[model samples]
Target: MNWRLIGACTLAFASVQFSPALGQTDIQSQRVQFARGASSATVKGTIKGYAIRDYVVGARAGQTMTVKLTTPNTANYFNVTPAGSDTAIFVGSTSGNSFRGTLPVSGDYTIRVYLMRSAARRNETANYALAIGVTGRPAAVAPKPSVDAVVPGTQFHAVTSIPCKAAPGQPTRQCKAGVIRSPGGEATVRITLPGGSERNIYFNNGNASSSDARTPKFSVTRDGDTSIVTVGAGERYEIPDMLVTGG
Candidate 1:
C-alpha cells in the first residue's frame, strides 16, 4: 500500500509561524481548492496544504531544490528562505496563478504563504491546500528507446555493441579488435553504445541480454533479411554468426 507520510505536524497552516500565515481559515472544501503544481516533494496536482521537500527522493543537503505551484483563481504570494539566512531566495507574484523557484542552501526553510485579504475563515481551512516540498533537482532524463524491429524470417537475431563516448565523440570499443574468444564459455568485450552507454557481453546474435543497458552492448535491427554490424562504425565487421561460421 502506497501511503504519503506527513513528517511535520498536521495542525492548520496558520498555527505554524512564517509557514503560510494567510487569511481564509483552513476550509474543508476539496482540501484547499486544489491546483496543480510540482515541487521537490510531489508530482502534478493541486496541493492544498503541504511542505516543500526534496526533488529527488532522500535528497541530502547541498542539492538544488525545485519548487513549483499553481493557484487557478486566487491572488497569493509565496517565498522560501534557507535556514539561518535572513534573505528570501525567491519572492514574486503568482504569474497567472503559477509560481516556480529554486533553493540553494539546505536546512529548515521558512516558506511563507500570504493571501491578498483575510476572510472570517482562516487560510488553513480548505479553500486550497498549498503543498510545498524539498527535493534534488531533476537529473537529465534519458531518451526513450524505440521498439526493435525483429529479424524478418527468423526469431533469432544479432547485434553489436556501440560505445557511448567513443574516443573524443568516438564510441568505446575493445582496444584490440578481432575474433575475441572467451577462454571457456563466451567472448565478452567492454563497449559503449551511441549515447554513452557501456556494456560488456558475449555478443553473437543471441538472446535478450543483447540490449542489457549495463553491458552486452550490441547493435540489433531486423530490417528484412539483412542484419548488419560494424564495430568501428563500418570499420570492422563482427562475424554475424561467429558460433556457426567461426569467422
Candidate 2:
C-alpha cells in the first residue's frame, strides 16, 4: 500500500468514528433538594438551542407531585418520566404547563425540560423557573366505575336514533343517541356518528351547546318536532323533542 493512500484511509476512519459524538447533545442533570422541613423547591436555569436539562427528584409511590413551569418561550416544555421507564406519563406541551398527580412507583423521577425541534434548530434560548413539590403519603385509591359499562339503550334514561350528516353534501346516516338527565334539569346527550365517533351535546336552561363551543358558526333551529343543531360550518344533527322530554 502507498503511504499517501494509507494516510487518507486512516483520516476517513477517524472522521466516521467521531462524527456522531460531535453531533450528539449531552443532557445536564441537577438533583432537586427541598428546604429543611419543606416539601417543595424552586430552581431557575437557562437552556439554549438543543440543550436539555433534567431535574431529578426522589419520590415514593402514591405521593402526589406537582410541577409547574414558567417560561417566555412557547416551544419549551417538560415531561415527567417515572423511575425505570423511558416513557413519560405527563407531557407539558399537551397537558398545559402544570402537572399534579400521584406518582405510580418509587425512585428518582426525571422532569426533562427542553425546547421543541423547531425552536431548537433556530438556536433559541429560554429562561425558566421550575417549581416542584411532593406532598401527601402513599395511599391506595379505589378504582372508579368505568363509563363503558353503561349499556347504551338500557342504562340511558332515553335513547333513540337521529338523522345526522358530518358535512354539507355528505350522505345522512341514522346515528344512535342517548340522553341522561340530572336533578338540576341539565341534560347530556351523547351521539354516536357513522364511524363510531361520539359527540356530546349539553342542554341547560333551554340552551343547547356542544363540548367545543369555540366554533363561531354554531346555530340551532327548530322544524315541528325536530330541533336542528349545526356545529361549525356544515356538521348537522336533528334532535327530536321526544329525546329531550322522554315520550
Clashes of each: 51, 0
Model 2: lowest-lDDT 10 consecutive positions: 13-22
- Give the lDDT of residue 122 in candidate 2: 81
Q: Model 2 segments beyond 4 Å from truth? A: 1-23, 140-247
TM-score of each: 0.28, 0.48
Candidate 1 weakest ten by summed lDDT: 138-147
Which tens-of-lDDT digit does each residue in 1-247 have in candidate 1? 1112121322211112133333333422211111345433423322233322211222222234444544442544555544433444445342333343332222355544444443212332223334545434321211111122212221111223222333344543532111122222233233333453332323333311232132223464432332334323332223233321133
Report residue 17 deviation for candidate 2 (angstroms): 30
lDDT for every model?
0.32, 0.65
Score candidate 2 by TM-score against the native. 0.48
Return the top candidate by TM-score. Answer: 2
All-Cα superposition RMSD per candidate: 20.5, 20.1
Question: What is the C-alpha lDDT profile of model 2 across 8-101, one tens digit per residue?
Answer: 1222112111010112465899999899999999999998878889999988644779999999999888888766545465777667789986
Question: What value of lDDT does candidate 1 attain over all alpha carbons?
Answer: 0.32
